[model samples]
Target: MKKQSLVKGAFVLTLAAFITKVLVFSNSIVLSRVLGPEGIGLKKMVMPFMGLMMTLTTIGLPVAISRLVAEADAQGNRGKVKKILVISLVITGSLSIFVVSLSIFSGKYLSSFFLTDPRSYNSFMAMIPIIPIGAVSGVLKGYFRGRQTMNPIAFAQVFEQIVRVCLTYILVQRLVPLGIEYAAAGAVLCSVLGEACSLIFFIVMFKISHHRKMKISRPSWSQAFRGKNVLIELLQTGLPTTGNGFVISITRAVQPIVITKSLALAGVSSALITKQYGMLTGFVMPLLFLPGFINQSLGATLVPAISEANAQNNLRLIKRRLNQAIRVALIVGVPSTLLLYLYAHELMTAVYHAPTAAPLLKLIAPFFLLNYLQSPLQSVLVGMGQAKTAMFNNILARCTNVALIYPLASNPLLGINGVILAISVGVILETILHYSSVVKSIGYALDIPNIIKILVAGIAMGYIGRALFINLNNLTSQGGATLILLTGIVFSIFIYMLLLFFLKVINGSDIVRIPFVGKMLGKIFPK
Candidate 1:
């Protein structure tokens, strides 16, 4: 029953995250298609700043809420969990108001300066309303995650994405024909409406869940609203995590600023620069990073298990679990990055209808490996109660990213490639810092042999896939590209897995445990 429950939780969360990622990808595609690269570029410009605001407002409180609630669950302390929830709502909600105000009042100046085009002002305005709604929704979702009740968050995500896609389709089609300004407004409004819908869905879900619990044992409002305890717990969990999240948000947000400047100095026109940035950061990077969803789900499931082991001072089990986390991260991340690079053009053309994005996609695909692997590593740190280390490592990386970006991007010689290089540089540095901490805390190198194996396997497979793709493109008509690309992908997976199997890099058992692959492997490679 326990194993089943864990698997169930992981499965649901995976589905939820997968859907959320798809929705987000859809949102980006629609925004880009409707407003073009210029509009999407404007949105990207504001994203980092908005992310900073949202991070500060929430201040890691939602994640802290989850941790606190989980801790309370371990102790069978419902009163403590209730108190944390109430406090989380109050703190997150209040911060949301302040952020919303800042966004609204500062929208005009921000839109003009961040984006080369001033026409994105209306879209900026639409984003202001999203702050408060988004923050509240975040807290609620975290609350559910902590309680090990993922359905509420999952359902809310699906509902939110549906709302977002529907609104974007309706609004963009109606508004973009009016002018770029109206298109921008429509884009922002889609976000605001989507967040609002998610918030409402969460509220309903929370109420239903709470009502069911109420029938069992009434929760006292006064007790649940205890300020002092909630504040202490919230601070204990949220503050450090907030710092960690801040680092990540800031690092991602600044990519555009760096890229745009780099392009401008390279003699690229402002009008064309957005497309360049979109090619790498906006499109390719997301697909590469998709496997992180698996890592995240695994990390989430591992947290409670690790927490239990921690309470018992079970060092061996913790080490075993940590190794498992790293292995799982590699298993997902390595193949995904390679596959992305192999089919970079096909994937980009299929999704964005833009073939020019191919080179940038290849350049940025490596970061997918770095990005996804870090999630599990970070989780291991948090589980071990070293959230401060994780926070500092993230801060250091973001600072390095910022520092590297400006100088590299300002160089007239490098252009948009400078920005891409800067991002990759920062990522490599960050990975080093993170791994150092993992080693210091756990007293072992971060499975370097496994990483090497994965990399080699990926490279060999990528080469084969690319060769096949090139041949196909030469032999077949343009419309046959999709069929050829799919064939190459299948071939890549086959070769990679066969090599890994022979090398014993990953065994049949590991393959048998992954969702669809496991069942298929059973049929193909009978025990």
Candidate 2:
């Protein structure tokens, strides 16, 4: 397999991500409409625990394996690469089995003790087997990434999402007739099967690719056990990388517990509480985070590009990339923030048929421009070898988030709105800390005038789009609400771009990246 260049690989991964996100979003819409918010809540109730279990299962092995394998492969030490794989598999494999076992035996006890809804036991058990399969898959994905082979990994991702969504929808439809619990459990079971399929795909690809490239003599169990140096190297690289995810997963696991307990104390019924939780996570979050695809795609470009620049001690280049990253993030973020804020009700109703989530969406929308920038800023930090700084900052913010959930949510007046407040504030804190760290480290000043211009452009576009939508809303039939909403958002984003282009907020290079017309536009546009 020929390795892809950095740009080509990012393109492959970004395209795959776009496809998978679409599938995931469509799946969410279907589930929300079919199983309703409470069903989503039930499925989501186990997801945090699953995330924590997965974090423990991998234990930084995949990242470790990626780094170690790349180093060994670069040095032409095939034997060391093989050893790294075996050790990582051994470490993660054992952890996976342990997680699977723990979940199996303790499923009832856990759901009863930890969850506010003990009825989630079925969904919990249904998702247990996925731990082992997903852990192995992560290791393989790391191997592929280490080798710079994006195609197979990209294919496997899209394949798994397609399989998961289609299977889950079919299964949920069949099981919803029984009960929401059954539907949720069936959805989880389908996810497990989908992961199994991805693992199998990875295994086949690895075998074929590995055998064709080079033959490796199988090491004895004693030889594998003797890789003390390899284990240390893997642990050293993997642990620090794992820290960020560890914090995130732990915080996620803490959320439902805190919010549910608090809401229950406020005399909110369990069912309504679940529905509200479902509305927030399943509906509101997916929509808000949809625009993050831009940040993620650009962030991928930033890490390697900035990392290379830093290695050369080219501070000027680093400054340029950092500013460009922030600019791009805001370029996507501002319009997205306004779209969600201005059309929250129409969007919620049109997309998910869950209008009740609109308020949460509206409340959180204003703060999300900063939220979207976190990824790009964090990428810059990672490029500068300041990942731990970013991690600790995230830890502090999440701690604040968790601390606020209980106190605010337990107040009947605040309720789930309080939960949104907690989340938005945490996002603000994290992004601000990230921005300040980058600016302080690089002595980089943002393009204040350009940023102001972009903000003014975005604000102007937002009000115009809202007025257009309202006018069209009165003219359009009720059945065409989805179409109208979709059209409105697309036109609004286009308008925002035009405003930027006219205001000179974005330059020729920005327009030059568009697919077909970028060159023509760039040639015509001024610097």
Candidate 3:
């Protein structure tokens, strides 16, 4: 695919991701009100196990399939693409079943031992079916990604979030009368239904797309057996990637347990500790991740785009893509970090009505811009066949987090703050490592001056916005506070764009690359 097409695909996926995040944010707001901190805490606790299970079952097959299929598609080998998809499905499907069975059988043991609170057992059980359904969906999404057509994957994402939020609200409402535990479990069960819906959408879309391609004769049984090399290639690419994900997943699974236990040891009550955990995970962290949808979409597209370029030894294209990816990351991350830092209190109060999360949001806001950049950098590494490098870096960072969190969280003075510090440090460290790895892989240094200009622009825009907000607050009544904030934010965006233009951070060429409005902007700007 052309570079313009890649950018367009990323744009489409980003828009979808934005909508999805909004739905998810809305879902979290409803859940926060309905479930309270403890119920939300129980629900959050079950997520790590679910993540680990899905990671284990998929075994990085989606990424491997995407990379391999991109290479095949680049070479115009339809048969190879078909073969890769079939083998991936078989491997992932079988592993998913095994994982689900294990999850069902071991739920009691896991919940009893690993979780600090045993009340999460039912939630753990409810999350088991998400594994197989997600596993199937992962491969199908990978197939579409390799094809460089993002609409299906994008639609599935938004559709899944819609279903999840609706189902979770309905289920939690009905189950709340029984108990918060059952309510939390019911909330967790929504993932199973959501994934099932996404899987169906992916299957239908894949069939529709597949039927449009020219027919290729099916390979005979012996020919299929001869394609064992494809399976071997998948394993070779997948194992290291899976190992990286597995390490991260294991650390994540242990994180809540460690933090909660450490806080308990520091003389905090169990109920208070759970509430703190919920506040951090459910409220503050989601706010931190609000800007990540752009990075997520770009990272997803980057894998195939870079893989295809690498396959054809197109060094110039690879470098251009990497540079553009980094620039886009900064453009999004800098403004987001600044806005969150400046408006943490107001945003928390406005969105979740939880004042307690404001300080935590401010504390973590600085490092999260770097966190947003991590996914895209790691995706570049994977695209370059350097998955192990990214994996090792993540493992090192996660190990650091685990090592420091216990001591810090157990400290009487630091307590929960220690956990937050550990997370912030981990995010910063991981991004630095990933960035260094990408630099080494590409043999090109990032444009430091351009990054500095972007940051400066963002800082200036944030300051101006903050000033406007304060002035507006003094003039407006309580009823108009949200409106004032919104106006200030909109003005800040306009100022930021003008700064980008005036500072030469973005030029006519960049503006002209935007999908539909590019031409109009070019005509008006007349570079």
Candidate 4:
């Protein structure tokens, strides 16, 4: 990991994330078409709980490792860095052994008890092997983040996604006729294979680099004598985070169960329940979070950037960075939310061939707009060393959201829509809490005028874009609604860009923050 500036590192990581999402989204489209809603449901039924598995497997050590390593590296203690890594391996490896063993032994009973569908049992079992692959990778990833190295991890993620996409296509096709259960299992196994490949990549990279690419003292094993002290430190630092994450994971895992049971209480049949859940989780979620790449990129860089600023007591720099990140998020995300809302039905029809998801998408888009913007603010908290506060906030939001689901979703009139309403409420609550916390910590100010500017530009773009789509769809008769929708999307985005410059929501300083081409763009796009 070379010492790179925040913009350059974020650029590389964001590009990789973009490619990975494209691949994953494309793969999901293929799988949804092949597996249909119920089949997708079967696969998704086991995925949420995988978060719980991961929280157990890594015990949140990745965060601790990254933080500890960053502190040591700042002190120029290369020997200490290596000792931390060595100790981390011992700890993560031990946890992996125990988690994997326990998973293998209890897979059947656990699946039987938890999953509403028995058909998901095979997929559940198939996914168990990923716990270990994920553990070591998490440690290495944390190490690289601490080192501020983005390329290796970025390259590994895209590579993993590519492999997963290809294997899923081939394997699911071959297995579909056997049964949806087997197909789901095959897809799950494909993910396992992809993760294994990532593990291999990490292992090879670690060995080849030996993490010695920098000027550092020789690797230290003397910590082996005091491994107990290290272990205590690791656990002390990580356990609270692990507990918070475990609660969040459990909250996520329990949601589908709660949603399913509540829907049943609303008198929905089991089959339709599966279909709606599949559509919500598998289809709409992937589409809605499509704009998350921008927020995620900003958040990744925001953390270390703010951390650096805070280290020097540079409150101005921290506030400036926060403003810029939120500005970028709003500029991109508000328009996305508007366009998605305007074209929700067309998008659902075009992407998933399931227009039934249109209402769900439109209903959830506003909430998700807040969701996208919340990332950077949460990162602000983490960067400010208020991670525990942020964790508790998340815990509260999720539990409150879960608590609301049963009451609303059990209503016969609301049904699954009630579940959406519940979570959308959670998003609003979480965003508010995050914003308030950030304000209290740093006196951060929202760019209210610029937000108005984005909304102004986005609303105009959405309306014009929707109008264009309507005209083109009406004019064409050769099944060209999709082509029309794509064209309108392009046209709307062009107009939105022009309006942004006109309204000054974006300016030369923002352009100058671009990774490689900043200076050039800044010259033409002056503030």
Candidate 4 lDDT, 233-336, residue by residue in tens: 56655676787777876887799999999999999999999999999999888888887777777776666566557656789988887887788788878888
Question: Which pairs, if any, clash in model 4?
Answer: none
lDDT (tens digit, per residue) of candidate 2 on 1-527 = 76554445555677889999889888889888987889899999998888788888998666556555555655668878778777777787778878888888999988888877887999999988988898889888877766767788789989999899989778889999899999999888888898898999988898788445553344344655699888877776567668989887778878989999999988899999999999999999988888666676666556555555665678998887777767767877888888889888988888899888899999988987788678878877766667668778889999999999988889999999999999888999998899899888888777788789989999989888878888898897567877878878888888887889899887787666654466898898776
What alpha-carbon RMSD in Å does predicted model 4 have with respect to the real structure?
4.4
> What TM-score would candidate 2 get against the native?
0.75
For residues 1-527, what per-residue lDDT tens digits would candidate 1 score against the true structure? 01223334555678889998888888788777888977676666656666777787888776666666666666777766667766776777678777877777877787788665677677677667777887878777676766667667667778888898989888888976788777777777887798898989877777777534722133344444556867876776678998677566666666567667767877888877877766666776667666667777876766654554564667787777777777766766777887877677788898788878888878877765777667667766776667778788878777877777777766778766677777787778777887788778767555677777877887888888789878888888658777787898888888888867666677756556655456786666534
- Local accuracy by lDDT, each model: 0.72, 0.80, 0.84, 0.81
Q: Is candidate 1 or candidate 3 better by TM-score?
A: 3
Task: Name the regions of candidate 1 deviating beyond 4 angstroms.
Answer: 1-11, 24-53, 100-129, 168-190, 207-211, 214-230, 245-292, 295-305, 340-368, 405-421, 444-460, 463-479, 497-527
**Span of ten consecutive residues with least summed lDDT in model 3:** 214-223
lDDT of 3 by residue, 1-527 (tens): 22236667788798888898789889999999999999999999989788778888988888888888888888888888888877777777778778888888888888889887889998998898888788888988887887788888878999999999999878899999999999999999887898899999987786677534633244344544668999887777688888987786678779999999999989999999988999899999887877777888888899988889988889888888877888888898898888888888888888888888888888888978788678778888888778878888999898998888999999999988999999988988898899888777778677788899999899999999889999899887668766776888888888998899889988887767776688888876646
> Which regions of candidate 2 are displaced past 4 Å?
1-11, 25-49, 63-87, 100-129, 146-149, 165-189, 203-233, 240-243, 256-283, 293-324, 349-360, 383-385, 405-419, 439-453, 473-482, 501-527
Off by over 4 Å in 3: 1-4, 25-49, 100-131, 162-194, 210-225, 257-279, 352-359, 406-417, 477-479, 507-527
Better of 1 and 3 by lDDT: 3
Task: Rate residue 390 of model 1 by lDDT.
Answer: 77
| TM-score, candidate number 3 | 0.83
Winner on TM-score between 2 and 4 is 4
What range of 10 consecutive residues in model 2 has the weakest lDDT sum? 211-220
The TM-score ranking, best first, is 3, 4, 1, 2
